[model samples]
Target: MRKIKKICFYVLLGVIGIPSYAQDYSISLLPFSTDNYDEFSPAYYRGDIVFCSNQKSTIFIDYTDEKENLPPLNMYRVEEVERNVWGKAELFSKQFKSNANEGPATFNSTGSEIYFTRNNNNKKKIGNFIDKNNRLGIYYSKFNRRSNEWSEPTPFKYNNPAYNFAHPSLSEDENYLYFVSDMEGGYGGTDLYVCKLENGNWGAPQNLGPNINTTGNEYFPFIHSTGRLYFSSDEHGSIGRLDIFYSEKVNVEWHKPIHMDAPINSRYNDFGLIIDAFKKSGMFCSDRQRTSDDIYAFTPLYPMFENSQRQEENDYCYVLYEDGAENPDPSLFEYEWTFGDGNKARGLEVEHCFNGPGDYTLELNVIDKLTGEVSYTQAIYPLKIEDIAQVYINAPDTVEVGQEVVFDGRKTNITDFDIYRYYWDFGDGRKTRGIEATHFYTIRGNYIVQLGVVSREDKEGNSEKRGVYKNIVVVGSLKERGRRTSD
Candidate 1:
């Protein structure tokens, strides 16, 4: 990863102050990126990646883009060599309008069906708008298992020759189709839109509304399996020309989109992002070089839940109720409950928060109402309150990458269990031993700090051991994480 980062861009240095907001993300340009050709809008196909490129294909014969002076964009496939590496790319398919512009595709779970964008060239004409020149629209193709061939591409049912509708992204369940279009009544040159597939037919297209679509173009939407909608937009006040933003659906409405942090979003045009369900790794497009758009892959140093609300606060408060009732018309008697703590209350039920972890004897007594004195003891209970019997890790959950962090294990509480040694795994292939230890991380990312305790061996040659794990986010230097448009 360090090598990949160096290959991608220079590491930031010399900045002094802290970043206003920072995230642990690392990005590297895809090895398949070419010098002059444009590559963007990557879609995952099985283990390989299918992306659109303007590089000439099949004997250097292809149509040229009407405006860009570049060759027509065609879908290309590249097998993943390994993590952070890719093989040479080849023409994705010939069944689709390969000679015309086509790419930015989405595949169903089985890869048998595909939804993509291409120049309008279907035979079926709809309504009076039929004079199409280069307007793009959504297209679909199905694989024939027996013939081992792809069916001829067909335009979407809602496709119209009068407007452009491209960059189709299908949901994982195949129940929703998201795309970009310049159709009338949209917020900008292009806006994110979706259509539900129900009863074997695609429903009317619905705009994602102002929260996502702005006066600036919003396009290249990728719906992740986690119900998150990620797309690129020029309207959300980005750090660059265009930036990728993601919005989670709250209830039935889409929440306001969040701008992706730096590195994932550079100052140049950055958009068209697709991430896996776990969000640990994925790819996006960026033109930071000012030459042509290129595909780049990104991964998180720390896993998710970094800033989410911590788990329900450790609960120590408990409720206690008297078990038996004193009969014989005890209207003249009152109840008095004394907890193990130095506190007493008069009631049938009592709720208390203990001061510390220990064992004590609690007593319930019947008091004489007139004399205000204890009559007799009704219940005697042995109550034991102890901290969770496990190895405990005490440290900050978030810290700078190179800042030394201290881990304390003296708080560990186990009844009758003696610890002989304390061990630490820094989650970065580093380990040490101590009841208290200090460690620092080299690069920015999230690491699981582990603490292990070993008990002394008894006469029987048996010992008890326990280990615990906690997540700690190691942020990068402010200079490195600072948002920027260029080097």
Candidate 2:
């Protein structure tokens, strides 16, 4: 790590050249994936996952829908065998069965309660939905500890046979409920809506505004513990078909939605994303590999960051106030800073900027206006300038044609990172590896220099490589001097 002066109050995190926030995601289709079956909408529950799938159930033989000759979507539970591994998936419950379709779901923090999607006419005993459901509806159910089964499902008070209202997601505190609906007065196909749990019942629904809804469609709402909302939309845009997007509500308004990057998204329909509170790993639904949607587990190579400000590049600047000198007579002699790099300043306190990494003998002389130049030097300090702890390369940002520029990594400072080798890419079809290398440009132009630092593997056989870059400008002659880079 690069150490900042106590005055500056800046600390360098143990990262390479990367300062901007990003997540490198790796994904894998779960072992439960089947070619003929469809599975999606994974929800964390009871230290495991409950998802909607149309796969045949082992407990209920011949569970296929007789009308469609295909299995209808049903809730299934999968237990995690270990990290990033899951065992077989089975029917979520026998008591929570419905005659119509059952889709996306969300569970309370304790996993004892659930709010899920089902056909509004699931019972089909009332109103105009006697034979078929006019649209979807949200229902709540709880685990019955006495019978060791799920209790009877209760319809949401706002459930109307006129429009669709499904994909329920609950807030961490269960104080707010987010869901999708096309009930009317919406932007387009489907819009996200939320209701506050005032007293003991849910309040009126509030639209998420035009920023979240579009003329297209948005569904699969998942409210993370951080209050950021994740959902799928096609009107906003698409990488494949329906892509996943997330937005954070500031104050009362929601920020513009941000599209997720691929493998989380793909050239196929991707939606129903559920990630952990740490944002390190999670599972999502995508149809990139097969014709049917399948749940895939994803993990990030590095931790994700939010609300992180951009880091300023260090310029190797420092101030020398006391040169570790004994008390000297201020009336007799004044302090003069003689930096061995051909720079000199006279003061008790002065600032200096080093060009690059090297060893320099810093001299402190005492002189007075009343007296002539002091014959004796007050302090002789050995100042060795080293680069900040990174895959640091010491090179001039500007050079001349045919000028031998020294590329040095000897001063690369990193205590925890055990570097095995240093690799260089001059961006001119040339590459080399060492602590130091010398190169020259044939023609005057701009070239990007890359320094690759490789680390030794750990006991787990895991290693990483970090590359840092520098922009070098080459000039034809000395008369056309290049601009000096920041010190």
Candidate 3:
């Protein structure tokens, strides 16, 4: 009982290291993440999220906690209305939501079988009792879609009342079950363990080894469809508390786990990570607000590329054109290239130089010379051509009306070319010429500001005109900050 009492405090440890890689994703609170109570460990199935909660305000308002004054964590499901919006959460099932604890569930690919955590209790026989306290154990339930009801739960074959076994994650093929437990000879308080599902029977559980099981707790294991193992740990270097980490299987071995950097791994307890089937986005649990646990969702803004296999870049800009066809002969395809810098070439491979610095559109037209079929592709290739002038403008995107605003171009890159002229268009019928200019807006509206630069040192009438545009918003002025004095 003393060891079980310490389980709740396992999430409070905060000393750890941060991941070296940068986080290229954005995260926000799920709309249903309530401030009144705790919600965590979200498992996505189809369009719904099956999660754990201990709050009384949930749809299961009638579910009275049987574990003294402490609310028993129970499983609930919510329908995702949109990307970040979710409908009200409901008890997974009235009958399944027992007085005892039940939560942290996972479903198979078919969604017909579920593995969940529950207290060890058997109404029929004393032989099932590993000890008198009835510690945690794993349970399985089958869903009869035809009847729309879950079958009676059966205890996992390896569940022992003397120890704790929870947080199950199934492999893609459902051939292996990964879970967290405090079984004997583990690396720490609780370590991740896995058991194989062979011939309708679960084999002996095996520890995931030292690479994963640290001297601290590791829990909430999730296996992404891409075969990545994601879990939370307090021992591994973390931003704080329990940060999420993931490791990929390479050469039949698990690599060292990589920290999931923020805004995913904040200075808070973050765990229960499950990526969407598409692997583009997913959800996680965090107690960052210091109020109550909440669920957060994240999505990547760019394509995820392997860090070790990134293409090396040279000093000069270059483009590669591929046939992009299956097993086509190079001689059968003709290439037409447009550098978008007033340069064009026709060949399978050709290099061109730009005379100025700006964003350039490179187009490649591939023609099947044999069938006369043609296809084309284009991509924007930015170039900072050496000895060319580049202009950068800095201005507040929005400001109060009647406020004076400054537009500065001191950071502009004019490394090689000599600037002949600088022109500014304030979009309100006002024009000026200078490297830096200031203006005041009296009306509340949106204005487009344009900067045009003419640069060429040696030749007259050979100056190149480069223009940049930005939108500025003017709003009504705000009142001064409120001040209070002690009475």
Candidate 4:
């Protein structure tokens, strides 16, 4: 008689076997402008952060209105030499003008197309508006890398006559274009809309739903690579006048927006957030220091997944036995197992097994020394043996009469036991076949549904039946009684 060694593996729950470190993030402010009231909308594209600032110009005269004290803001580009060190800021003279206020910039993936908003006084002369000075509209300019010059800016064609359009952001795939607009037919002030960029033409815009926009204003919309949206909103639990808020799409619906807290946001205004997909470093403009608004970079230290930090322990063990033999190989071969937890082990004919029950990929690589060649790897999955095969039946527990209802049955355990046939007794003299069977109950009453499965092979060559039962209550109504049957 062979001695059967039953190695019981205890599957542990919530055990951290391997330690993981949090990803470190750092930021460096670019030396662009020391003058007060400057710098906003810092965007990273092709390894450079392009921003807007109101720095003192050496050649041009002061364009600020001495009475109102509004300075001219020109766009600038700052290149990063190393990881933390930023190169000197250079004014984009060829692209920006010295006339009116220019700011709130966005760039494409390749840094070829640049879109920005400019307060066009000339547009006021073309059309009269309530707030003439605040009549800002978006403009588009293409950058030619070969010549290192930007083309003349042109007004975007889709600007509505009712409201101003600003703060444009392109989707990572560049298939959809999102921008903030105070146009009509919106839920509230300055609603965000996305339009499909089809064949180089912008299509009609659609509102981003009520979750993102409210009766109050929502602006500076930035979409991250991970599909999380970041924007500024004063209406949604903000710390101050305008605070940055972020929300992600779950199950095709946007969840309730949450405020970005403390260091990244302050009591003062924080807007214009930008993040790189690769490094996950975020940049935004904040007036937290009580000085002028400066561009600040922050590394988001939050875990990527909500369940990423929580480790699930496996303590249940699976016992592996040969198909017909009780005691097989004691020292005839080697053992190699992959635990699927980013770990692996190798030994020569060992009896020790794993300590947990989970989806593990195990492989046994054997060697033949006489032939000087390796044998085929044998793979086996040790499953928990249960007496009753737990089957989940997915169907309505209650249904109206004459309604076609679907019954689904899923069986677990008994891997080699093939279900040869299925018999569903609908308790109304009607029977059906197949794992997922459909039946219509005629006349309203309480009925018991039974699913019978037959095993393909048995010792006597006869099929063995496995039964599953479910109780369904049927309601009788005028509409349900009048319903016609397909048969």
Each prediction's RMSD to truth: 14.5, 16.8, 22.2, 23.7
lDDT of each: 0.74, 0.73, 0.71, 0.62
lDDT of 4 by residue, 1-487 (tens): 0000000101112212222322333444546635465677887767887777766555545455343344455677788898767888877554576466565677778888877876645322222222334556678889887988888888777774446777788778877677888778887766878888888888888888888888777878888765668888766766565678876654345667866655666566678888777535778876655567778877754222111111122234443333332232535544454445455555433333455334555555454434534454556553442333433355788887556688876542335467666666676644445678766655678887766666765688765555656678988544534653422
Writing each residue's lDDT as its tens digit, candidate 3 over 326-426 gives: 33357877676778777777675687756544576776667677776565443334444442235656788898755668998665655556666667777
Best of the two (2, 4) by lDDT:
2
Report the lDDT tens digits of candidate 2 across residue range 348-397.
78999988778988888887658667646878889887655666678888
Of the pair 3 and 4, which is ahead by TM-score?
Answer: 3
- Model number with the top lDDT: 1
The 10-residue segment with the lowest total lDDT in model 2: 1-10
- List the candidate 1 regions with Cα displacement exceeding 4 Å: 1-23, 121-133, 303-487
* lDDT ranking from best candidate downward: 1, 2, 3, 4
**Model 3 per-residue lDDT at 122:** 32
Better of 2 and 3 by TM-score: 2
Please write out the lDDT profile of model 1 over residues 342-388, one tens digit for every residue: 88988778888877778978888888898999888889999887777
Clashing pairs in 4: 9-317, 10-315, 10-316, 11-314, 11-315, 11-316, 12-313, 12-314, 12-315, 14-313
Between which residue pairs do clashes occur in model 3? Answer: 17-237, 17-238
